[model samples]
Target: MIAILSDIHGNLPALEAVIADARTAGATAFVNLGDSLSGPLWPAETADLLMREGWPAIAGNHERQVLTHAIERMGASDRFASERLSAAQLAWLAAQPPVLALTDEIFLCHGSPRSDLEHLLHTVEAAGIRQATEAEIAERLGDTPAALTLCGHTHLPRTVTLADGRTIANPGSVGLQAFHDDHPLPYIVENGDPLARYALVRGTGVELRAVAYDHLGAAAKAAREGRADWAAALRTGLAG
Candidate 1:
């Protein structure tokens, strides 16, 4: 099966838990849709882990930041906060491709095919979603043949079949849950907590799995990093 993940945002613990879960499920290969950096901690570490694990990952907006930082650093220009990342990390991020056409019928991107920063969530109105899907298909597929497009940026898990029969999938954030005040829980909670979220895509079927991990630990990490907003949201799963 294809193990798809995205929007990790540098949460090593959450990523580790997701990886462990995916491994247990016997996923032969992994496809990462990016946003691997920029979070409470471990941006460089997360990139390193993905490299060491030999997983193929596409570049996200954050990765573009890293690349821009490197260019600025080389030119002796002021770098953004993220540009302060380690040289090794910058190199690794720079090396990542913006998109991955995995096979003749599968395409992976950090966002929409039209833009690396686009948000392709299925929660939108059908007309809007259809418009976006058609535009993406035209740009990426272009009559090459039918292909499965996988993307992540909205941090919301979704699987949609457009009016023209094109398929799009977003596995959501492996480290952060989509904002929902009522849910008030990050994707994963501690053992048997039933809050962790993930998606499995094999062939024409997509299965979303919300398991439990250690919310307390994740929250503590956020707190330790002085990201009160994130920590609070971890409890409520609300972005703001």
Candidate 2:
């Protein structure tokens, strides 16, 4: 079995709980879909753990932004992570690819195959956020020939099988559960509860799993860091 993780966003406690749970579930290997260490929680510590484990990982949009953008111009989450990460940690993030092929039949990407900042399974519309059509997903997938494509950017857990037998899955977020985004429009993604999330890939199926952790402590830590919005989201899995 393979354990799939994504969008950790620097909450080490949550990651730990998810790892333990994955082990108990008989996951023999692990793959990370990035957006790993950009948040107000434990950026450096999270980096340490992930780096030591040396799991097959990719770089999400936030990782690229944190590395390329001026620190002053970064958002709170990226800026906070940038300030806390050591030089080696920054280098580690820089080393990851925007997308990867785990095997001849399995592909991994933070978002779309074409763009780390784009959502592979979802789209932003004037009406609201919604799942992308098969055509749209196929377009974003481009010429990648992997039968199983794994992506995570919207922080939503989903598994979709294309008409051609290609499967795409998002395991959800391991840390932050809810977030508001404003790009072409404004929309929010929420899991409706505070829990650490991940996925188990077994045989030809995907299982979304949520594990309990010390979320209140994570909320208090975010509060102490002066991000009440993060604190609220960590507590309730709802944006403030």
Candidate 3:
């Protein structure tokens, strides 16, 4: 079995819990869909763990921002992680591909096939974010021939099977459960709980799973760092 994880965002305890749970579920191989260390909790330690694991991984848009943007211009989360990551860790992030074909039939990307910042299964408009229509997903997907495509960016666990029988799955965030984002527009994503999330791919099906961890401890650490917003999200899975 293969386990798919994404948007870890530096919460080490949550990642550990998800890893243990995946192993228990008979997952022998792991795929990491990135956004791994761009948070206030444990960027350096998370980097250490992920580096040791050496899972097949891809880079999210945050990875690009952290690597190329000047420190002064980076968002607070990216800046915190960038500051704490070592040169080796940064190198690892730099080396990750924005899109990866995991197998002849399994494709992996941080977001859509064309843009790391675009949501593969979602659309944003005047009303805010909503599930992407089949046409929109097809447009973003282009002509990728993979039977199964995996992406993670919005931190929402979802699976969509197109009318053509192609499947797209997002394993969701192992670290963060909810957050507000502003780019082309403003939006919020919330899973409504503090458990870490991932997906198990067995046969041709994907199972969305959540695992319990010491989320309060993580919240405390974020509070200590003066990230009350992160702390609130960590504690309640609701964006502050």
Candidate 4:
């Protein structure tokens, strides 16, 4: 079976927990959707783990940021400075391809097909989703028919069936969120404890799983790194 993951955003502990879960569930292959870097946690370490574990991954917006930085260092200054990526991290990110066609009928993207940074929310209309799907196909596969598109960016887990019968599966965020109230514990929380969102994809079926991990440990690390906002979000699974 294949384990699909995305939007990890450098939460090493959470990613480790998810990897353990996937292994326990017998996933032989792993497909990472994108956005593997850009957080308070170990970005380089996360990328190294994925590479060592042989997980196939696509490039996300953060990866683009790394590329842009490389261009800037080469005298092209149009890059986004907010990334603050290290040279080694930028090199690794630049090595990743923008898109990957997993099979004749399955595709993986960090965000929308049109743009790796675009957010394809579950609440979007069918027409919009269809348009995005077509744009993705044209840009990457060039008329190839894909039965399913797996993506993660909105951090909202969803399965949307389009009018043309195409399926879009969002496994949600492994390190962050795109939904949840301001409360301490929201809908998916277990007895007021926060959990990490994940998914396992086998054949045409996608099983969503939210596993609790060392939230306090992660939060403490984030705080120690002076990323208080990220630390708070880890504590509640609600992005500020």
CA lDDT of every candidate: 0.66, 0.92, 0.94, 0.68
What local lDDT score does residue 109 receive in model 2, on the 0 to 100 scale?
95
Best by lDDT: 3
Model 1, 1-240: lDDT tens digits are 878888887767778888788878877788888878766656667767887887888888767765665554432111322644677777777788987788877888886666675555432342223224456445544443445788886676777776667677777777776332212122221112225556777885677766556766777877886777667655556555
Q: Return whichever of 2 and 3 wins on lDDT.
A: 3
What is the total number of backbone clashes in candidate 3? 0
The superposed Cα distance between candidate 1 and the true structure at residue 115, in angstroms, equals: 0.6
In model 2, the clashing pairs are: none
Compose the digit string of candidate 2's lDDT tens values, residues 209-236.
9999999999999999999989999999
Give the per-residue lDDT digits (tens) of candidate 4, residues 1-240. Answer: 888888887778889998899899999888888778667777767767876776788887766765665654521111322244567656666777777788987887777676675555432342222234544433442343578788876677777665566677878778765233212223221112357777887777888888878988888977887777667778877555
Scored by lDDT, model 3 comes in at 0.94
Q: Which pairs clash inside model 1?
A: 184-236, 187-195, 187-196, 188-196, 189-213, 190-213, 196-211
Cα error of candidate 3 at position 4, Å: 0.3
Q: Given candidate 3, what's the lDDT at residue 26?
A: 97
Best-performing candidate as measured by TM-score:
3
Query: Per-prediction TM-score, please?
Result: 0.77, 0.97, 0.98, 0.77
lDDT score of residue 192 within candidate 3? 92
**Candidate 1 TM-score to native:** 0.77
